[model samples]
Target: MVVLMRRRLVWALAFVLVLSLTGQEDTAKKPARTISIVAERFFFSPSKIKVKEGETVEFVLTSDDTDHGFHVPAAGIDVAIPPSGKGEARVRFTAIKKGNFRFECSRACGAGHNLMRGEIIVR
Candidate 1:
């Protein structure tokens, strides 16, 4: 009886371990949420975005007018966005901290370049 109980306990522990590992794998394999952003002279559409902490996000950037850039210093993201009808740029990052991060244009577009900014709110 003692041997049988020991064997069953070992099997139960192994089962629990497998379940925990599988859960972790599922979390790691989760796909990042994609957010499309439009950049034009002076401002970015949807200037404020909210995301969950620890979530992965992808930003697809496009410009409607002249060339521009997407710069997020806190997240270490900087990408150039081509002009309208040219092409686009993509950046991906994980929101590990819960706070607000600022993003702006790295390239000079016009007099309003400084106003071309946005915020990412991580909750």
Candidate 2:
């Protein structure tokens, strides 16, 4: 009877351990995020994104015509948008600073290369 009780205790402990580990893994996984942004000849359709002070933003930037690049200086993100193609990018940051940050395409697209700009407003 004593040996049987010991074995049951061990199994219970093992089950608890497995449950704890599995719960942790689920919490660690990030939430699903999908944000669509339009990229035109020389600008981002939304032009600006408004986000809470601390939030993870998944930006899906797509080009309407030609290929372009998306760059955010403060967030340190650079993504290239293919012509008639779509791309995905993510940025996670705490809006420690409350202001408007600039985002532009690093790549030279055309005559309007200097006009490719966007903004990220954190409040």
Candidate 3:
């Protein structure tokens, strides 16, 4: 009877260990993120963003004036927001590289199009 009880206890501990490891893996698969950003004629709101290495970022981009573009070359994020204060564009990417990557306006809006730039810092 004692041997049977010991076997059951070992199985219970093994099950708990498996559950704990699986829970950790689930958490690792989900990345932490921040809020949204607004792109206008001359600038981007909250022009700088930061995220942890190997984590994902959720970007909600909207334009106030006309159609605009958001491009992050290093992270492979390119999106176009509609014109006339219309719908927004949502882009998601993983920050695997630890550096400062500049995101800019890929479409020409006005004289200040080149000045519309933002940066993402991954730690």
Candidate 4:
């Protein structure tokens, strides 16, 4: 009877350990969410965005009329968006900080290039 009880305890402990490890694995393997942005001559569609801290995000930038750029100084993200129907630029970064990060057009598109700006709010 003593030996049987010891075996049962060992199995129970092993099962609990496996369950804990699997839970951690699922969290670690969580997929990142993708956000698409459309850039025009003077503005970005959906200029404001919100994300959770410690979550990963992927940005897909595309142009409508001319060549534009995406620049996020705080997050170290910089990419050039091609012209309409040409192609797109993609960037991925983890939101580690909790604040607002500004993004703007890196390339001079036109006279209103300065107005082309957006913000990513991380909470």
Error (Å) of candidate 4 at residue 116 is 0.7
| Better model by lDDT: candidate 2 vs candidate 3 | 3
- Tens digits of per-residue lDDT, candidate 4, 1-123, equal 999678556645644554454345344544378799999989998799898998877677788988888888996566767678766666665788899999999889999999999999999
Could you tell me the lDDT of residue 46 within candidate 3? 84
- Candidate 4 residue-wise lDDT at 62: 83
Q: Model 3, 2-121: lDDT tens per residue?
A: 996785566456445544543454445554664588888888898988888888766777788887888888855567665544556656667777999999998899999999999988
Task: Please give the ranking of all candidate structures by TM-score, highest first, separated by commas.
Answer: 1, 4, 3, 2
Q: What would the per-residue lDDT of candidate 2 be over residues 10-55, giving only the tens digit for each residue?
A: 6456445543543453444443454678787888889988876655
lDDT of each: 0.79, 0.66, 0.74, 0.78
TM-score of each: 0.75, 0.66, 0.71, 0.74
lDDT at 80 for candidate 1? 73
**Candidate 1, residue 119: lDDT:** 96
lDDT of 3: 0.74
Candidate 3: pairs in clash: none
After superposing candidate 2 on the true structure, give the runs of residues whose Cα lies further than 4 Å from its correct spot: 1-33, 86-96
CA shift of 50, model 1, Å:
0.6
At residue 39, candidate 2 shows an lDDT of: 80
